[model samples]
Target: MNQNRVQASEVAPRAGLADISILANASLTSVTGTDMTSNAQGSYDLALKYSGTGLASVGVADKKVLVYALPAELQGKVVGGATVDIDANLLPITPGDIPGVSLLFGALGTAIDGVDKLVAIPAVKAAFDSLSTIQNLGAYQETLPATVSPDGKTISVDFTQGFGKYVHQAYVALFDTLRDTIAAIDVKNPIAAIPVKLLQEASADLFAIIDAIADGTSDILDNALNANLLGSMNGTLHTTVSDPGVASATVKAGAINNALISADVLTATEQEGEAVTLNFPTTAVNPIENYDVAAPVITQPVAGQTQVAGQVTLTQPIPDGTTFEAVVTLPDGSTKNVPLAADGTFVVDTGSLVDGQTISAKVVATNGTYTKDSPITTATVTAAPIENPIADYNVATPSVAPLTAGDPEITGQVTLNQPIPLGTTFEAVATLPDGSQLTGTVESDGTFKSAGVDQLAAGQTVTNG
Candidate 1:
């Protein structure tokens, strides 16, 4: 049973009920209507009421309501008719409205079937031909403002300005055909075919319309006469437009309190007209002090020195209201600060340092704007050399002889009145006239000698003690 057939340019009219006028009387179980117009004829009358009962031979077909083009395979299919009670007021389209069957013949004016009256009017003309095929798909042609609510039981279908231009022309033609089909695939033998629940419902409706257009909410559709569109449900519609003025006043109230702290208080009815509830103070304060000081180690006048007096020990330990100073730097390049003394010791009187010069120290420390410095430590003054005093010493009289007779010999020569600094050593006392006290060690230039002097009684006299 392949049937299908419906195209006569898909039949039209429904818009404002095109010049309607149905009026059947003769007690035909009801069917009333008056001069309804529209197509600019404008008289808009649509009430088609009728209560059950054998609508008396249904006869009175006057000013057209002929509608018939359904067949896009009987849309939401379900067409069997013969009940008849009737009730049409129409006007409530919205699914990207336009070519309409006045809401599927006003919801099939209830069980209607004056004898197969076009069998459920082809499922209400296949539900307005599926809302004129989704208002002409692709870049979705337009048409979407269907409001009706004042107690008429809500219809509201504002595709927020044509759903943000049909989701930005369907995400720019689906990412430019997925970047030209992944740049003509073959990335090392690549293969692809994904629909994964329609790309996760188009990535959760494009991140909930980018988090409701970054918080100014209203689900995006700022109406420049509509076309910003993009509501896909989540909290329906909102964005009545307002965000553009921050170019650059240098932007910083702590970067707008760190970008609205955590946002959520801008009420004044979401502000566009009056509702202004701002209140920002989320507590938490202190955050800008900053500090650093570590570099003070010197520890006193050490490294090869000859004279440096008084305090200068710093292996760093002055941190409670810190204050040290000590500079120095002198080998003629003059410099001197010198204060320290709260434990990191320091004293600098170098007494006009001389004798081999060279000073160099460094200690710094401060602490309110933090300061640091301590790596120079040098020293060299050398001053301890002066000696000249040996007034008299010329002992050279020791001649006791007896060698081959009894074995006794003593000989000597020592003289140093003044010139001593070459490995000096002098100790010679010899009173050998039977009195003996001898020691020898004065040689470099002054001499002293003794040859086993034990038998020294020859003439018994060798004195020079």
Candidate 2:
């Protein structure tokens, strides 16, 4: 067959999150090509740009194709079972697309026409002592050659396409000896280098599947390549630094996630800023959370208030007149009592919250006093108090800067132990299921006093804010 290399860039949009660049060129280094004497090479190299920040850019190569980096916001709460998409962009085509088996054989020289060459391949030590020198010779003069593929139709050849008519007769003779030797190996590692020296002989065939064009062929390669992409690791490996002095920088190796990892990989051995190497084996799995849906977006905090109020107002998907009540459960297990309007909203008085608290929320459909037994949708919210002057607490119209009557913001009050150094920031903080976090701005004052940063991520437990 004849064709052109499918343009991965032009096809990127159809593939979505999967990396198109890596699938076309990368190979694994640890894997030896099926041939020891042919034009085989180890795994490919795939490079990706650092597109995210802080936590999101932790480059972890889980496989030649599998790459992973956590998001900054999803940090800490990430668990081991989190699921990520292995982009389908690398999978090969379907069986129907090709004339026969799912494997695609393209325009390169084929078994019927190409010259063949054989090279000694490393064998498992178990059979090494008994292996005959006669079996070791790659020549077909003394022994018969094995067919390129099991179907008995394919012929193997190197990319260079050397040799003459003598090669034809040599192939049939050498094929048998190589086949016998390969059959002699343990079946458990059929694909391993020591057993499938058949692959070294068949490298040309495998290459075709990656480089050819067919309906499902590229998709098959896309899927296979995607399985090893870096972002698929699903578990975490963590390391921590002790008492790193304030002035002394202490760095520890970041966590590693290795699920879906089929091969060993390279990583940074030292801390964040240091240059190093991490030789990973086949077992590292990264910990992550498989959110069933797009993570609920965090709404911007109402203006004026330093803490974002723990509240939400969603329009009913079914239509009008539906109302729900919200019961806020503090990290301490105490629940808040509140009404959800027919417009679909509930709010927590974040202004009265305490520091360093964790919270989560659950909602139940209700009409004032009678509550329904339906499943409750949940969210998380965390709010901490600030030390702004009580004088700021006149509570007129519940006005927070940029405030809206519908979703009023709750400002926290806090006193800095010292004047914030020049260029230093004083931010508001809120407590939610993830953890208590520093929030908004203080406008150059060491006294934090803004409402913008105290946004609420959906599904988080709501506390005072």
Worst 10 residues of 2 by lDDT: 37-46
> What digit string (tens of lDDT, one per residue) describes model 1 on residues 26-100?
111112222212111111112122211112221111111111111112122111211211121111123323112
Tell me the whole-model lDDT of each prediction, alpha carbons only.
0.33, 0.29
Query: Model 2, range 87-205, lDDT digits (tens) per residue?
Result: 21111122212232123222211221121222233442212222222222122111112112222111111110111122222222333433354455443433344324443345345
Q: Show where candidate 2 strays beyond 4 Å.
A: 1-322, 341-343, 350-356, 367-465
Scored by TM-score, the top model is 1
Error of model 1, residue 443, in angstroms: 5.2
What does the lDDT read for residue 361 in candidate 1?
A: 70
List residue ranges in candidate 1 displaced over 4 A: 1-323, 327-336, 339-349, 352-365, 369-408, 411-420, 423-435, 438-447, 450-465
